[model samples]
Target: MPGISARGLSHEGRRQLAVNLTRVLALHRSILDAYIIEFFTDNLWDTLPCSWQEALDGLNPPQLATMLLGMPGEGEVVRYRSVWPLTLLALKSTACALAFTRTPGFQTASEFLENPSQSSRLTAPFRKHVRPKKQHEIRRLGELVKKLSDFTGCTQVVDVGSGQGHLSRFMALGLGLMVKSIEGDQRLVERAQRLDQELLQALEKEEKRNPQVVQTSPRHSPHHVVRWVDPTALCEELLLPLENPCQGRARLLLTGLHACGDLSVALLRHFSCCPEVVALASVGCCYMKLSDPGGYPLSQWVAGLPGYELPYRLREGACHALEEYAERLQKAGPGLRTHCYRAALETVIRRARPELRRPGVQGIPRVHELKIEEYVQRGLQRVGLDPQLPLNLAALRAHQAQENRVVAFFSLALLLAPLVETLILLDRLLYLQEQGFHAELLPIFSPELSPRNLVLVATKMPLGQALSILETEDS
Candidate 1:
């Protein structure tokens, strides 16, 4: 339960965790570095120590879920049936200790209501056009940004990467914050502007319907700006939008919900370098898109550390939902066979055309219903290969029999994924600390609903009491 908070880990603690992560990730680089499509051809199973293979081999999907992923049956305490090597066991324990906790410190809207039977009131008007997942995200993130605004005494909020302005609209209309939404795409910005008018009309109609209810409403819609954020430099377009009528340079809070790759980095850089931009609350996704030297390892400490390099494969794997996969494994669903089928198809591709290695296979629907031969045929056709190519039935059947092994190996990679994510986020936090700013990585969203749940919060000043109150329901 002891993890990073608003009052963050000490300098030494951050370094130590970084060191532990680098060492562990380096040790298991083979597992994390591998492509699952090469699971068969590259002899990935043999790469694991014989002891690990022995302990893991032949385990059913449900057993692997409970044992490796720590998803135990209700009231069932998980214990190892086979003897695992001490080194392997240590890896699991170390990984669990080093990864940032996905368990949120804050209570969700559904959890906060006095009447547990009632639906969430937090997302009322904001939930209209949004999906359930996006609805949950906008509500939680919007509330936090609102709290951050109050804590920082910032009236102006600039939402970068504000796609269709879901978060921006909620903050402006729902929370009454003076907001400006900046997005790269012109079309999305236009749509957000349209949605803003629609929501305003909806709220006005509600007021008309209920004459007795005196509700405080938003003063205006969020100003929409269409511009790409350059991580390397500050854009006047982003800065010019905030206008403070009262005093000095406009006090601003920069925010992004699931800002992709370098866009999140741009927010951090702006928060650090721009005097007006005093705060940041960013939840970043698509680690694979992060650029080397610029997007990752922003802190000198991590950059200098040996073996801290995270390749694209590892970063992509970090985005997967471990909890969701574990539930699928529990069901022992036939869909789990997809990985094995793809890997088998890879071997076939290589045999047919040696140069074509792991080509993208457009998804074949109803995968669970198809035989390995049928799956491979459809896969070859999708990849522009000969679907009529002769196949060895014996080899195909052999690969199909080892579906559990493929899933188990992929699970092992999934196990170390959080550590990769932790290193990346910690690098951001550490970068902020190096610049003498206060920052914390908070699991602000439900991991099940949104796997990339941790939001990196940084401010020019320490939050103090405001930190504790941010996670609690607003009274």
Candidate 2:
């Protein structure tokens, strides 16, 4: 929850960060490239230098959590008995420095309330049909879009990948922004429309009951549109929906809340190519799903740099919630063994059919309850292998005993996760800057609540004080 305050990155700052990422990523490519599922099959432990293995081999889950992951328990001091390699220590410090700060610079709706006690009910109406995590996301993002639209003098707000319209409704009805919600799924669009009506009715009743208590901000429901936005080409359907009353001269602010894969790319493209779009705020996820030909290396600098390529596995790893996993390690719960259990299953799978490499196994319920041998049998059956295959009890026990080592390695990989996410976001910011637009990346949400917390904000004009204002909670 703690991080450095947000600062806008200069052109030179971004370039240096990119160069630093390229160097660090290459130096630690072995750790990043090694998938946890291939731990036994690939002899992943041996892959680490003997010095690293010695230091990390005996670490308990809680020890790994505090020492390597920087999540110290209350009043717990971490003192190492065995001297760690200087290179390893440096890698930890370097990774932390290169990653973008993910703590929110902005204030939450709860904190912005005049009475601190009323924080719980500030967003009460908007909380219907929404989980706590999503409730937090929509309120923060909607407030941001409202500020951007007001600053840019945008007449409309376009919410791309507007799932179930939680964000669109909040922006339109709660913040009084003219919003257009677009989603690729027809069913989800219909569901959003239903929720919109339900919310409108609820607000009307609340207003009638307590007319003096409720502020009368002119509220409107967001118009829902069903369309798949393609990153390669601009869709007329996307642009034609805006019925701007401002003399057909519609200045727009585009926003996407957790737009997945190339869909986020589409938002960036539309913002760049369309003159109507005056500003953009995008939060992207599912990096593994991004297309190679068009999705990554958005700026020319990264494309030209050697060893800048991020394979699908590495990209997938970037999407993990580092903070959440660190908490799990601190707890040292049963779930920590899942990774080791799955890895052991992989070995059994390979022996059954040497060609079957890392095949997907369906989730086994209450897997931690099952013994290693039982879990392996169930996994084999799930992967269409014979469950009756000869058992290797000794090998399975050996793998189980080394569970701590497996967890330590996984934690190390997670330590580098933020750097990968940082590089991807930096590339987007650089891309916008390369095209002569001003862009800044800020961690707008709590990383624990949302792993993909960094939001890339861009405006055609220079954002001077607005950059800092975006971080400020309204008083």
Candidate 3:
């Protein structure tokens, strides 16, 4: 008989009704037993107290209804009716809680961010024994390749601008696919060949030296199967001529690993229009090569895009103080960090030695007006190195500067570096899609391993299908 009366329940009555409902559920048991069992077993109820059963057994519906109807002065009994399905729900949700555990292989939010190394193993094969940092990058590239294979169904690959042929050999031997490495720089191409031979000899020697070491070596090695091609001719001549040589047997894969500036854009264009070329994967770097739209002729397609403009240098014409500082830092190489620490020491010394703090006595000069040799001589003189030493101070200074500059510039340009390269890569992807190839942006390496980690994957799906896929993502 306990329930909400016709007059509707007061706040107190509502509370009482809820309590009564709970009691009814506990007493009857059969009323909502299945739902209750399900609720208790569900992940949502994992943290619920075991004493919830006792709280639900003492509710009185009739008294709750009377209080709600405001009939304290009247002896007349009011008809009670069932209100909201409180008892049913109370039975269903006694101990409910949502599960937060991740399925295996799926990284949890915290895990991915806090401990990236947990998933670092996924990339280990690509990086093992090569370089500690390069592993993550190789893994990222592997992920991209897998995604490309799934999306396009094209497995054949060609690596343009293939430096050292390490990645080229990787794709051939690791992925079990045919790979042709094309390099424009004769010296690099030759170096890659020589390295390839040396690697093969090393593997042979290792196998002979200790068979166990061979067993531990990765299945794919730089010595493994990979055809090296020297495209001494410009990309334009190579792309068109290479198409004829393939004889339309398999999809011509045009890929470039860190293709600088125009080289990347050329690959995109080649894959777009050339029917014989089936897929294109290019990761572009060095945007300074792309002339402003008005400065040079871009492909008709790229020039037609809305707001399309020729790319320009970040700090046109002149280097800023930060840039100069970075250049000096990079030339210092691995010792750059140490040199920076030393700079702090120098600052302290400068403060202590007031006489040494001349107006123009900064460690390095900002202007190129004086050759680096002259600057070094000036520095050595200040630091008491012989100013007239017969040593080629110019070359030594230049070399030191160059070594330091690599690391210093990298640290300084970290912010803008990825943006410029990413935009160029996206542009190439758009070009590929426009040319009738299905293209996707994939992370080819970890940011730590290499800042330039994006790969644009394009394949000839149907005539317009590739564009549609790209459009869907854009929308």
Candidate 4:
């Protein structure tokens, strides 16, 4: 079957899909828990489908022990473990969602975009320049910024929440676009400025020493410079160049990489309201912090729909895994247990220091090597509880025996995570469409390298130009 084609799909159609997706996610909403509460909680098992319960019920500890930790005698369970009814249920709901929401027809921006620059080696100089993750984002998003520049004939960019300004520097120096970076943190702004100066100086020294440059006309002139600002707020006053026209910069391509929570929404709002802001290529993270304008149903249609109240933690579930569903099952199982460990400690705390009733502990030392009693006691001490608090060793051992069920519980939550995230992204796309902008979501980077990899790329082009770009997809 053909993949989803966002241009070919209508905004109402996307809305309808969002409505359908909410049902699928809500079906198991009761099973989902905040990661902070996932471990040491027991109700997740109740939310499991009856079939899953039956399958699990059929297995005794001796029978189910192999798959949990793969001990020697328990290997037999692995042999007969072909059927995964719970996973099938999750896949079934996902398939239903895939039918409604179109895939935007492309993964990386490079697929639909023309070569970002005439020169083939745009990222070579930046090879050793930044951290591995930052380097990946710098190249990928930099290419998109360059593509937007070439598309709109606007070489002006505003990088919002420009931490340490790694992306901002690339947009200005590598692409030679006029950049205005706004960061809330003053220290990062200073650091970004210092690095920008150092790099520019180093390039100048190299050019003078060689005298005879390899490339004619100097592909990189170092003439371009980045303007940095420390914004006191997230309001439009800081976005002057893009929000309202200023000298020499009429239309601006507003780009932000990993603008957490409300920052991405603010950019989208700016894109819709401000005409001079011609384009947006933004990636958002930290969903937990997004201030719900009204509630879980952020879009008008989703807001009006029945049974559409989204919890913040469930909204957070959407970002569970960016690459593949299988990743959740294979590698994430151990990490999921850390939450369990914390919750288990919380349970112990409640029992011994019932009056104190300290609900949760912020930071605890690692608990892997320590036995359950030692682990619980150490965790108690870290949280300022009585370190010498007593725990029932045998009973605690029995509680630990239920570790497999906890994994099952988390797996169920993980299944719903992507669907929830998609619903959120789709709602944002629909919101943009309502505001009269052409928008689409794209997995613009390698998920393995960066989990929060999908970017919401949109443009405010005229109908003719927009159609031309969509036609290129078929070509």
Candidate 5:
């Protein structure tokens, strides 16, 4: 990927990043698929060089993610000895791809340092009204909308896939902009409307108690409208009716905090084509759900590459959480052990009852803090198998002795997570830039709090026009 998508970069610089992902994923294909082999099936004893197993046997869970990838040199691996030189090849290659994709995927760190505080943007009444995580997202995203709206002279905000209308309520009630909260689920749309009514009532009651109340806005309009509509099927005609009736005309700022899968892409497609859509700030999630008619490659440039097909497994890998995984590993007791059981049980099912393996173990409720013997017993019951059916615990234990291999295999796959997300986002950013929009990615919220922290912020104006507003507002 391009080092960084500086505003100064040419269109070709941004376009080249489109395929940077395809090439990296293809290069690592064999090494990645190697992870699919069951731990008990092959010792992979031959795959690792001499004494590699001895080193692996010694390291703790928290040390694994960084053990191999962070340290490729002898001095580095000596600290966490399990990583064989040969295995380090794939992990090291993935790290390079990740670095390239990540650097260009967003604005520099200083931009985040420059973001206005949540306290300055949100009033005390509004701050207390929302959850902390939600509060952070609202202020961060809200600031983006403010920039976009001011740049395009837009008076309306449309929150797509606005689940439960948290952001919509914040925009309409707190920011004093007209908002149309579009949710795919009708039940959620109704519930969001009811919640808005309750919040308005509460705010009014508080105003009576504290006459000196520093409201988010004295001009606040309680016009938080809810609509049940699939964004893919929505058009400008539908949007006209949803607009704040008080305004004679309005430019719409289309946004989604974490629009799932193809829904976010669809929003971008609509926003790009629709003349009414002046700007957007969409943060996407649930990449595995992204549908691929031609292939998983969404951008035209990436799709044009021959024999390139992104699988669901690759998208699944993209969702891996490095920070969260490390934190889990550091926790006390058998907390992190839960990761290994499900994969091991899949092997058991293949041997014991292959016919029952069709739908898979997704619905199996977690067997919290169970020993291997008890875990299998409870796990069997979860899949509707007879709990009394005895398994050879001794044999399973022998296989469990190689638990380090399982952790190593997963950690290798986890390395590609951020790269996959970057490639996907880069495609979107490049597409928007190609459309003559000043497009860029911005990180919102602490990554530790929210794994998918990046938001694609863009506008249909000259480069300096939109970003200047962000700088001016900051000053």
Candidate 6:
């Protein structure tokens, strides 16, 4: 008979993985402690578990010596031989994930990622002329619009911040709904009108080109018709004029696609106050523009969480390496190794090329300072290339200041990015919830298309039961 063997991970393998994680976590703790010491100088690790000390105590010098003896003859072979720090880092990440999962928001995040219907309007047309990069997203939006139609029994839509009127045209012409596409930017509004006129001209030209095509159904024809209006006037000066003509028979759709900062909040407020509006499908972006209770606005909702606060007068910095890493990872799918490599290469390039320092190359705006590596990766990606060399932790540390200097100029601004965004989203969600609307955050597109992918979809559910379900999931 064959010898019995233990299934799954061997005892040694399990132990090693755990050890690695523990070591990594310890390193993380050390880093956190150092940061706190530099700032607070007291009670640095007060909240941390003392178990870490006990774990370290268990490792004798003999074991460490034995491990070090097996190292390769490379420059950093000794460092590689020690696994304590790596293990601690891994453990820290695992613990963070576990803790995050316990939060109410965590469950909603998972469910929202898995289920679009949680907050989506079923009636929205997915295939608008906007030509969404992702097919699934477009279909989902279409489904949402369809659902909204059924829920509100509305036949008209008023799209706010409508760029080029692509969505509005699709809904009005394809879905046979009346549409009023509003845009704040005069240039975009002009472009949309021009596009509409061009489409009509193209249709007329096509008819002349092939008279026999007249037998085709109008719905099946390739012709498109869209109407464009000024968004700024619509919400303020034009509201009365527009509503007076429609009277009370028509249900309004207050929809905005990636409306920036305060614009989104403004739309929500408008929807709340506008009794004629029956439904809303708004996606907000640029959280830094939002004003908080103290008048200063942030970009992230997490910044406003119980334990988090916006750092005062913090200047944003560009981390080209991070930005490039984020951008490529987003575009290249979920490849962690690739992302790391790209980030590393970026650092090298930034150190080598100081002249290429400019804004808008990678996502790092001129307003923010960026790390060298981040700049390099972004510059590389902008030119459709990847970093040609390998970069490890040692190399990173060797060039830390050079890498950091690139972004150090805008540290405060950089810190504000995530914080401001998190707070804005939280505020928006809370507002929706307060209004008896069930809202879900969905990744509207891949990270590559835009970093602002988290979309809040809110709909009227039966007696806020959906919110209760979300709360239960969080618990």
What are the root-mean-square deviations of the candidates from the true structure over C-alphas?
2.3, 2.6, 25.7, 6.8, 5.2, 14.5
Ranked by lDDT, the better of candidates 3 and 4 is 4
Report the backbone clash tally of model 1.
0
- TM-scores for all candidates: the values are 0.95, 0.95, 0.45, 0.78, 0.82, 0.48
- Residue 430's lDDT in candidate 1: 89
Candidate 4 lDDT over residue span 201-305, tens digit each: 766666677777432433332222233322213355445653344455577677779987777777777777777788888888877767765323456877777
Which wins on TM-score, candidate 1 or candidate 5? 1
Summing lDDT over every window of 10 consecutive residues in candidate 2, give the lowest-scoring window. 1-10
TM value for model 4: 0.78
Candidate 3, residue 362: how far the Cα is off, in Å: 16
lDDT against true structure, model 5: 0.63
Q: What digit string (tens of lDDT, one per residue) describes model 6 on residues 1-475?
A: 0111111223343233333333333333333222211111122323334543333333322222222112122242334233445544444334333110111222222323544443232223323243333333333344455456556666556666677666555455445555667676778777767666655555566668779754244432112123333223235421332333444555666666667656676666666666656667776655434455432222133223343333322101111122233233233232322222334444454455544332234443431245545545565666455654444556754444232222221121222233233334444555555566555554443332334545555555442333333222111
Between candidates 1 and 3, the one scoring higher on lDDT is 1
Error of 4 at 390 (Å): 0.6
Q: Over 4 Å off in model 3, which ranges?
A: 1-130, 133-135, 146-155, 201-248, 291-311, 315-423, 462-475
Candidate 5 lDDT score at position 30: 46
Better of 4 and 5 by lDDT: 5
Local distance difference test, each candidate? 0.85, 0.85, 0.42, 0.61, 0.63, 0.41
Error of 5 at 13 (Å): 3.0
lDDT of 3 at 174: 49
Alpha carbon lDDT of residue 465, candidate 6?
38
